[model samples]
Each structure stands twice: as C-alpha cells, then as structure tokens.
Target: MVFDVVCIGHLAKDRIVRGSEEYEAPGGACYYGSFVLRALGLRVAVVTRLAREDLPLFEELDSIGVSLFPVQVPETSGIENIHPDPDSDRRICRPRGFAGGFRAEDLPPGIEARLFYLGPIMPGEVPLDFLRHVASLGPVALDVQGILRRLRDGELVIAPREDQGEYLKLATYLKADDVEAKALSGVSSLEDAAPLIAAQGPREVVLTHREGVLVLADGEFHRFPFKPRSLAGRTGRGDTCFSAYLGRRLLGDPPREAARFAAALTTLKLERPGPFRGSLEEVTRLLASP
Candidate 1:
C-alpha cells in the first residue's frame, strides 16, 4: 500500500509549559505527523519502536485504522520542556532514556512511503547514514533538533556539530525554529538561511518562528504569517506543520499550497493539547481565510 506520510523516530512523554502552567502530552513524530494526516483523511503509517508499556498507544492508533509498522523496545523515552511564557516559547531538557534508536531491521515492511518525516528527539540516535538510506525509499522531511544539539554543561542545548556537513547533504525538506535555525545554519533570515541550508543538500528548507513559517525550494520562496491566535495548547505545532505539509504534498498539492495548509493545520493544533486532536474541518477554516 502507498502511504501519504510515514513518520520515523521515537515518542516522548512531554512536559508542556505555557507560562507558569505545565502539562504532559504525548510526543514523537510518529504520533504528531500520522495523527494530523489521518485527521486530514489521508493514509498514514508509522515505522517506529517504543516500549511494550506503550502498547496501548498502538492499540489506540490501530482502533482508528491508522496503519502501524511497530517495533518493540524494552523502554519508552521521555523529555521535559519549560515554556517561559504564553508567547509560545520554550526551553527543553531531555531525559537520558528517550526512545528513538531505530534499526533498519526494526522498520516495518511491504509499503512505499511517499513522504518520510524523521523527528529525532535524541542526537546521534538516527545516524545520518541511516537517514540517507531511508530517504532513498522516499522524499524525506526532517526536524533537525536531534543532530543540531549537544550535551553542554550537563544541559541539553543547541551547539555546533563537528559532523553536520554530511547529514545536511541528505535532507530534502528541512524545518527549524528561530533558535534552531540560528544554531543549525548560523543565519538570521529564514529565507537567507534557506540557500545556506540548501547548499548543504536539501531541495527544500523552511525556518519557523513564533510569527510564522517560511519555505524556499525549487527556485521559489514563500512565507505564511499567522494572526496569532490564543491557543488552548500548542505542544505539537511544528510536528503538525510538517505532518500536514507532507500530507498535502503527497496528495499532489503545490508546495505553497502544502506549506500554507500545514501552517493552518498547526495553528489549529495550537488550540489543542495533543497530536491527532485537530481535524480537517478545523484546518480548512484556517486555510481559507485571508
């Protein structure tokens, strides 16, 4: 079967903070990307490994008819973030045991994924070589938080990588936030950052800030700015963005259309607490308005 979006990597139990308030939400590219795509009425699949303790999450996905190519590991991984304000900004602290070390053998079979998104929660878990192999199977989308970070002074922070020169060469659709772009590409303008990012290898690159998302690829550039909605929760905004974008793109939507739809999907998700909470109706309304 053909999959609209196949998300790789691990899941996390996230401690979400908006201002002084805190809550836990389920995280992992698998959940976020697949959930939003399914919500959009598309075929979605997950190729991942989590602890057996997390089996219930799989059962939950299965009941909804979301296809799963599951692998079991001994433990589940976790992460914590402190959002300093309601402005939707955050600082993250990762626990040592987060769940994404995907062996190629562990990946599920008999499917061709059209769009592959890899959200690596831990640095060095999904090797660049492994990603290149995966991309050969499809167009790859990535959130580089995993590789762009390092353990510094015992805190999880974005630091320069000694080995990024090659991994950047393998990515197709790349995404990063303000801080992440600063760390990963060393440029301030997301568009200016795109050429540098593409110089590394991706055919398309985007930089997202609290204000909006920017896309540059195939010799074209575009930006989508949101009107800053008051959110119920925005724990998985970027994940939702990447997921929805891939979903639309796989459906043959143009890049600008795909990116705008993704931005709308994420804006709606910002009003919810978890992955899979936003719907197509919600995403459409946001996408249609001026």
Candidate 2:
C-alpha cells in the first residue's frame, strides 16, 4: 500500500522524573510523529520494534488510522529522563532497555511511501546500510538525535557521529535541535549550523530551538517562533515540529509557510503532553493570528 510517510524507529517506554513527580509515557519519533502526520490528514505507517508485552501500546496508533508494522523483540527499548530543573532543558538520560537492531526483513514488503522518516531512539537501532536502503526507496527525512546520542557506561551521551557526513548524504530532509546541531557541526548558531549541515547533502535542514523553529531550504532561511502557553509537553517538541513541517511540505507549502505552520502546530503541542491532539483548524487559527 502507498502511504504519505513511513516512520522507522524503536518504540520507547520513557520514564520522566521531575523532582517529586514521575510518570511513564510512550515515546520515540515514530510514536509522536505518526500522530502529527495523521492529524494533518496524511496517510502514515510505522515500522518499529518493542517487547511483545508492549504490543498493546500500539493501540493508540491504530486508533489514529496509522498502519503499523511491528516486530516483537525480547526487550522494549526505554530511557529514564531525570530532570533536576523543570524549566531547563538539561536532563540525565539512562538506558532502561534496548530492543535490538533492525534487519531488512523488519520492513514490510510492497509498502510504498512518498517520504521515509528515520527516527531511531538510540545508536545501533539503525545502521548505515539500512539507511542507504531506505533512501533508495524515496525521499528521506531523518532526525539525527538517535544517531548522535549513544549509551555510555549507563548514561546517554550526546556527541558528534564519526560518520555523520556519510549518513547526512543519504537524507533528503534533516531534523536537528539546537543542541544536536551544535554537537554535530561545532557551531552554536542555528543559522550557521543549518547551512553547514545542509552542505553535506540534505536539501533542507530543520533546526528546533527553545524559542523557535528554523528551516534552511534551497539556500534560503525561514524561521518562526513557538508561542506555547506553557512547557507542559516539551518532550517531543522536535519530533512534532519536524513532522508538522514535512506534513505541510508534502501538501505543497513553501519553506516559509511550512515553517510557520510547524511552529504554530508545535506551540499547541507544547501545551499538552503526548502526541499532538489539536486540529488543523486550530493550527490555521494560530497562524492567522498576529
């Protein structure tokens, strides 16, 4: 079957801790992004792996009309995020479990998509050859977080990938947050880092920061601020923003318009936990204002 986008990643059962408060939630770019795409009226499919016990978690995706291609492994991948400051982006990430890596057989045969989104939750979850194979299928939108962050001893460390140039060349669209961009390009400015990353091969680079979303496409830069009322749902900010941006792009919106739509959609997402639950009308309304 043909789909607007195919998301490949590991489903995560994330444990979030903020001082005296703690809770568990479903996570991963595929988990968050599929919902955003579906909400924008795009057909979506997800290829993921997790423990058999976590199979029921996919019910949410099914409810949203997202096709699932799940492969059950012995363990479900997870992370424990300890946030000492609720207002800050700093966090201590520890690996809880890893579901193992993907193989060619994991992707369903006969499935076609306009865009393939690769959003692994950690290193090794997606390998180089696998990325190359997917890129051959169609346009690829990649989130570099999973590749840049690796499990070190017991904690998650964010660092530049040794072969990032090779991987970046495979992606048509790239997503990276300010922190991740800094680590990969050795530049602190999003405007500067976006072009540097894009120089590797991606035609477009989407960079998310605490204050806004920035897009550099075809040698031009576009930006829009995220006016979230609160930071209640900050965990999947980049995932939501990137998905919203691509959803609009697929619908024929230019980089400036797509960036604005993404920022507005992501602002609404920031006011709630979990994947985006707001309507397109709401996003349109937000965009029309000011």
Candidate 3:
C-alpha cells in the first residue's frame, strides 16, 4: 500500500526526568510522529535503526498498523532529558547512546509516500545528501531540531548550520519550535523569523512558541493559540504538531485549516503523556469547542 507518510529516524530509548521522578520510555520524533499519523487514520511507515534488543519496543507501532522497516545496529540511540520543572520549558539534554548513522540506500526501494518526514535525533543522523534525495521522492516535512542538535562535550546543544538556506530549500513543510528557529534562522523573534525562514525555501514554515503556533504561507502569517488545560504531555509537542499538520494538508485541508487542526490536536496531545490516543471525532469536538 502507498503510505501517506514515511518517517525516517532513530527509535530512541529515552530516560525522562520530571523533578525527582524518572522513567525510561520509547521516544524520538519518528516514534511519536508516526504513531500520531496512524492514529489520525493515515497510512504511515517508519524506517529506523536500533539495537536488536530494542526492536521489541516497537510492538506498539505494529499493533497500531504502522509498517516498520528497521536496521539492526549495536545499540539503540537514546537521550537523557531532565526537566527541572514539570511545567517549565527549561531542561538539560544529554546523549545516552548513538545508534549510528543512516544513508539513503537504507530506504526500501519503491516505497511510495505522499510526504517524507525527516526526524533525526541529532546532526548527521540523516545526512544532507540523503535528505535531498528523499525530497526528490515526495514533499518533505522537516523537524529542524534534529539537524540543529549536536553533542558538545556529551551535552546536547543547538548548533546552527551555515547551509541553512540549502536545507530549507529541500523541505516543503518545515517545523521548528522557538529555540530551533532562533538557532537555525538566527532571528530571535518568531514574528521576525517565520517570514525569513519561509523566504529561505519551505513553502510554509510552522513555528511553535509559548503563545501559540505561527504559520507562514502565501506571504501571510496565521497564529493559533493552544488551549490545552495542562502541559502534562509536553515532551513530543513539536512532533505531534508537525505530523498532524502535514497529515491534514495531505488530506486536502487548506493551509490555515491545517494549522488550526494541528494546533488543536497538539493542545489535546499535550494533556496526555503518549502520542495522541484520541480519535478524529475527539479532536474535532475540541476544535469545535469555544
């Protein structure tokens, strides 16, 4: 079957710390984003690399009907996230494991997809040439976090790339949070950066900030406020937003409507811990709520 989206990245074994409580769980943008896409009733496939022992952690994706194409490696990549406050944005990021890198040849041939999502956890996870090759296959949706994140003395740090313009040109839809936007575009304000980021190349640039989501499309900016009652499930906020937005666009929703739907769905997702488990009806109801 032709998939609606094909996500490429590493499936991570993440150790998350919220205040004094800590637990290990499955993570990585591809892990969360693919699940949300499937839940939204889209045909999704994930191409990932992980250790043999970590392969079983993907059972949830199998149960959800997402096609998994994995590359066996020595160890599963991982991250250690320490959230100082459960409700605050500040956190310490450290690399737990490096799963090794992937090449374009690793992708299964003839796998058709409407959108190719790049969800690498760190720089070089997916190389620039590989990213460009995938863009030739279909519209590409990029999560800038992966490209900008680098290990500095074992700590995850946001590193800007000099080839930002070239990378942006390969993405049809680009998703970046406030921090990532500043790091990549060198603009401190989303208000000032969204347009500049769009001008760099993505047909639409979606920037998520504390206030809401800002989308630049067709020379106009549309803002949507997140109405989630809590930030309980904040870890995958950007992943959820980008996946849902791209799914909506593929299903023929206008750019503005897609952004709104994505924001509403993400706000709801932020209220829970895992990938969006809610149905389309639930998200619709939330979007309908005043």
Q: Model 2: number of clashes? A: 0
Which residue segments of model 2 deviate by more than 4 Å? none
TM-scores for every candidate against the unseen true structure: 0.91, 0.97, 0.97
- Name model 3 segments beyond 4 Å from true: none
TM-score for model 3? Answer: 0.97
Question: For this target, which candidate reaches the highest lDDT against the unseen true structure?
Answer: 2
User: Tens digits of per-residue lDDT for model 2 on 213-272?
Assistant: 999998999989999888778888899999999999999999999999999999999888
Whichever of 1 and 2 has more TM-score, that candidate is: 2
lDDT of 1 at 48: 72
Model 2 residue 248 CA deviation (Å) reads 0.5
* Overall lDDT per candidate, in order of appearance: 0.73, 0.90, 0.86
Per-residue lDDT tens digits of candidate 1, residues 243-268? 77767777888889988887777777
Residue pairs with clashing backbones, model 3: none
